[model samples]
Target: MYAHAKEVAEGMLGEANVKIASQNMGGEDFAFYAQKAAGAMFWIGVGNQTTMERVRPLHSPHFVMDESALPIGAAFHASVAIEYLNKNQWCAA
Candidate 1:
């Protein structure tokens, strides 16, 4: 992710919640999109830690998500967008 984007995300989501993942060899389509535009892709914590035993890895048949985090994820997206736009003066356009 771009440095500015990461900074924006960290500003919106507390630094403790925003983690900088180590570089990996994983293939993601977002890499192509990012080549042409400034963008970022983030993962939200959807697993309920209290029910760790019930939680399953993504794509697993028993995979389950804590629905309560949905609103927080939504807010994060909106906050990032609004803050990025405001900083870039895009909202005034």
Candidate 2:
């Protein structure tokens, strides 16, 4: 899926306008995802600043972030939600 998204993005927009960001996978969350079906998952609450910081170090105890990255995360999540809704034929109930 990531590869396909990258290909489409690059085809539609120049490489300069496309940024590919993939999260580092695997952690305690791996166990959670394994036990459930594809869609069932969990949410962790970390400050957006903290998330941006910790994400970079990959592994560390004292992680922090600036608040400014919130909008990007929100937009990314919104895009994902819309994709899922369309793919699964979901509607508000």
Candidate 3:
């Protein structure tokens, strides 16, 4: 599943720009979706800004998502969906 998704993602968003997220400790419950059908979840980087000489964690008062990642995330989803649908005729294109 990821093999195809990664191919589509890297194809649309250059191989150099693609990044594999690390440090996934406790797995996400979202994996349950795969049991019903082929499914995958991916991450998009929102960048970190230095705050008080350190990078703050998520949900912090100063934490903010870099808007630049929005377009990339949108494009990634579109590309993955298009590619997957192309391989399988889930519905009319």
- Please give each candidate's TM-score: 0.77, 0.42, 0.75
Query: Which regions of candidate 3 deviate over 4 angstroms?
Result: 48-55, 90-93
Ten residues in sequence with the least summed lDDT for candidate 2:
37-46
lDDT of residue 82 for candidate 1? 83
TM-score of model number 3: 0.75
Cα-lDDT of candidate 3: 0.77
Estimate every model's Cα lDDT from 0 to 1: 0.78, 0.49, 0.77
Query: Candidate 2: deviation at residue 59, Å?
Result: 5.8
lDDT of candidate 1 over 8-89, digit per residue (tens) = 6677777788787778897789889888988888778899879666879788999989989899889877877787677778
Poorest 10 consecutive residues by lDDT, candidate 1: 84-93
- lDDT, candidate 3, residue 10? 83
lDDT of 3 by residue, 1-93 (tens): 788888988897789977787766865787787889887777777764543345556769986677777998898888888888888876556
- Best candidate according to lDDT: 1
Query: Candidate 2 at 36: error in angstroms?
Result: 2.0
Best by TM-score: 1
